[model samples]
Target chain A: MANRVAVIGIGQTHHRSKREDVSIAGLVREAAQRALDDAGCTWADIDAVVVGKAPDMFEGIMMPEHYLAAALGAVGKPMFRVHTAGSVGGSTALVAAHLVAAGLHQRVLTVAFEKQSDSDAMWALSVPQPFSAPLLAGAGGYFAPIIRAYMRRSGAPNDVGMRVAVKDRLQALKNPYAHLHLPDISMKMVEESVLLWDPLHYLESCPSSDGAAAMVLGSEQAATVAESATGRRPAWVHGMAMRSEPTMFAGRDQVNPQAGRDCAKDVYAQAGITNPRAELDCAEVYVPFSWYEPMWLENLGFAAQGEGWKLTESGATALDGGDIPWNCSGGVLSSNPIGASGMLRFLEAALQVRGMAGEHQVEGARKALGHAYGGGAQFFAMWIVGSERPN
Target chain B: MSKIPATRQGHRPVAIVGFSQNHSVRSDSTSNEVEMLLPVIHDVFDRAGLTKDEIGFICSGSTDYLIGGPFSFVTALDAIGVWPPKSESHVEMDGAWALYEAFVRLQEGDLDTALVYGFGKSSLGDLDEIFNLQLDPYTMAPLHPDLVSLAALQARAVIDQGLGTEEDFARIAARSRRDAMNNPFAQIKRDDDVATLMSEPYLVSPLRRHCLPPISDGASAIILAAGEKAFDYAEHPAWITGIDHRIETHAFGARNLAVSTSTAKAGAIAGVGEGHVDVAELLTPFAHQELIVKAALGLADSVSINPSGGPLSANPLMSGGLNRLGEAAQAILDGRATRTVAHATGGPLLQQNLVCVLEGA
Candidate 1:
């Protein structure tokens, strides 16, 4: 059996379009330092460090973790780097947690970041390769058709994406670290925004920001000691999983990826959850674009097939009155550092379970789900956290 | 200060059941990464007498800069055709680290088998210019110091400290080339005398052209099985006894270039000195680096080092590290050795290192 692990510390930078105040190393250290403080530990307490990012092109550096090792206090310690596209953040944390769960380390610090301001992410992502057809322009161009397919298949209302865009921006007002705080966000504003890709308005897309997220995962013994000293309960890791499929195939379902569903099922099963909608109090899912909220709702099995948009229309995913609130921290639609976006989702879920999410806290949240996907929705990483330890 | 854990107690045992590699070449211009990996993946599965469906998980290691395109690993997945999807993850480091991740996942006791692979085509771009990106962006990278010059600095340190001489490097290079003659997959094989090697022009001061590893394009794959599954896959399994990795400060000025503290720490944690090592494979891309790593590992003089010519014969960037591990495991699997140690280095001038100890049951 695997050893028990828990999240004892969590920290993130105030995401923004550009964090010109600090260098890449400095930006990562700020979050790592905050996490160290939260866990009531020093640099000496960490057994290893795991770093993650989307792509090296975002910063014009190949494997930037090697350069930031000293800045992150990884000297004379095990330092590992992970890259799994956008889902890299969640996979990075999962790798760190496994160290503790495998009885290899007592405490591990995992971090993910993206300094998109250093270069044009869209251009970097759109770089043409040899012998491959340049059918897509950028991520938006590739995913736009998928959203259109979902609309045709589900027959959802045209205003659904606009509603999600407004709702998430409204929630960002409550999150101090959120990049975009649109106080006057409304459906009219989203509807009037430019259509960057057909069927997807500019307001419905995720913003490119420079940011990072970090968490300190500890074994059961370390968590107990931290709790006794700080009087703060740790968010127990009930279960975690990752799944991947080929980016392209003839019969692949781009709208509702099987990888996401299988990953959710595996994690939920390990958490002993039979009904995710009833068991999970809230969710922090990777909704890079507004439409992904409903798409993932069904993919995660929180709603029946083709009925996910109805759940959104029924106010079931809102933090104000929803039973199973999602994206209480504004989610990727509000701020996306690409690589760090998935980790923010995972971190927010832990925050909700620990009752540490001050303004965006879901009341009486005892269990929550965190979800992230990348690379044409072929890679999926998800985890379930709870206030109480698993049996 | 808390001491690092010396050993992982009661963890599940995992072994390298199968391994395969493509012949190292200056350039594989015709085939992309996926195309290069397809045959190697099939060969590894065949070597283990298993099918793709039997693998519980898959992991890979590669960098985008080699191909100058983002999500290179994503496209490489086409080789496996993951129809129902599989538990998987990836690392940006060398394939040895990917194998480490797979080893850890097996400790969860849910997965029985995993496939790990790494590939890189250094000829696709100017590695000298591209490698500078690994330095500190705010300071070292701005200087545009190439990899060869940085390695030369370490070589200079080794010589200045009297750890070794130019003749020692020449002998090691000559021995590697002589050994490569028996290995068909080696990129550079020549039976040259040490005196002849010493006459070659210096690629950089104190570092002759023979001292550097040949830039090659290659792919390698290894299949790992846990506990009883290891025996079912390979008749003589190379059981992984211990594996550990550590990183040093990125600032060269802050470190002792003549010694590899990170390698020593990892070797100690991996229990390299626990038993007699019959053979060892060190990923010393630069000839003098072998001296530092061999000393750090504390291997006896009787231990055969780089019997397959090591990276001096062929260095394929991300894949080279895993190749060392695979070579060490092959020694045990082929009944040529009972126990072995493998070492892999990453970053500039051995800033990070990984050590794995394997033994036949």
Candidate 2:
């Protein structure tokens, strides 16, 4: 097995609520082409391809990987479709990494995408079948209560969420490919927005964007080849881990899921770090909802229990002066393609580690963490990357 | 037992350490995916003899459109019964791909054991037309090219190539349905013959009801243990020593409809090179597809095929692939065979293929 694998290239599309102009295949191809160009390679350079999306119903396609295989430049090769709920983006990357980590393939192209515009997600997610009572209307409706619980338990002020929304929107201005560019977005705009899911204002949530994200992942040899072609140092993978528990069982804490914590601890342990807040230079954590920033801050053990909201309130997570800038690329709230949201975080983290984040770059970032969670926070995929090689 | 003295070269390596499957039926009247999976999920945990706490990772595969729902896996967590959570992920694919995902995770050395499963109930709506959504929505779906016609095209291609006659196909259909008489989980079992099946007529030219896999409503699970933990799970766990998957293009015009190159490549990687397959459980929805896959995998003439009736007996969409592994594992468990190879195919003309070789090592 290869001792180390790195991300040599990353590309993502402009996310939006609807992509009527392009087909699903075209949407994914846009990102894939950019990734290949960024890696300074062509389709033939890729040994395998792994694609991930939320569900078949989201687009009313029953396992559409077959149709999508050709679109992603995967004609006659190993193409895998991974669906791990909302965490599929992260899962796809981890799966690609495994191909390298297991000494199986050298350069693998991983893509995750979603076109919510193709069908009604709410209708697709909530199909009243023969048995069981309907939960909330859709995913947001289902998770709203959990967000409310976090607020009540932690006594977080409502303005904390508003502030997060404003900060992320401002940051999105720097990212050309972000879907939501609320140039005029501010705390006042968020505060005045209608509460769709109690405390979750319309402005506080991620838009259902039609987009894709792709990355060229390679083993040591592949990365070396890329470095010569692209004239860039690839982000060195330091440590990675994935964990999962049941969705909802007895004594389940949706507010602070154990799976997220276990995933964080495992990756940190592998990276040989005791204090996450002190050890990492920057992090691109999944934050679809503004409140998730603080919620995940606590779950990842970056802040003391019940003190995550304080980090957000104190402005310690800003890209300019904060100790650990979370989502310097604006995160899910600013640009979301449901299936690719997790990969965006991972890609952004790689961008920071490779010293190529442009205007949003965290200065002198030597090490970074990419984190994502999905399916009511039951799944987690985390990776630590650094400029220096692991011993 | 036939004293073949199983040579290691003839036996591929892969095993069923953990197995879980939900109840099978035409339709599941459930609120969410979580509820449907809750019950039988324990079987995999129990059969693998590992607690949820011990599982290093979790990978699942399922189609969202199966139940007319999107992000089905997102809500399926209600059944996973996770609280305080665990490290887990999902794949938008068949359980076979989920197994592939779990396999990759195992190689990461983060965890040696993983839980992988896939579920789908093709009863929620017009599954055949719904599958049209899998095509290029703008170009192919508007044309409403049903899945049956596509398979019929492949079958017709085979006929054009003189691969097999329609009579041969009818015999395969009759044999599979007849074999289903023994499988309790088979939904389309009938005491009928090829003559009756042929007389009934065609849903599409060169294809009949018997020639098609029933719109099965089912779920399946498999536990994957890496290295040493695999042995501790079961007395003779189906250790996955050789497993690989590959894909072809989706464009109908571009692909050769008569054979499965992906399966050939995957089988070669899975060490099908010199092995004498004892029981080959093939997931071929169409009879002609069975022949195509058989030729692709290069199975010997004497090898027993579809011992558990196969997909023609009862094809259950997403779970069908895992069901093939289960059937192969059951054979090993019964001591009827020491080695077997199970195969699964997805998409039109078998665009994707997964090969799992198992033995009582």
Q: Candidate 1, residues A131-158: lDDT per residue as tens digits?
A: 6876557788889899999988999998
* TM-score, model 2 to reference: 0.93
Q: Please give each candidate's TM-score.
A: 0.98, 0.93
Candidate with maximal DockQ: 1
Task: Evaluate candidate 2 and give its CAPRI docking class based on DockQ.
Answer: medium
* Best candidate (score: lDDT): 1
Chain B TM-scores, listed for every candidate in order, come to: 0.97, 0.92
Residue ranges of candidate 2 with Cα displaced over 4 Å: A122-130, A135-137, B1-14, B18-39, B45-48, B74-80, B190-192
Q: What are the fnat scores of the candidates, in the order listed?
A: 0.88, 0.79
Model 1 whole-model lDDT (C-alpha atoms):
0.92
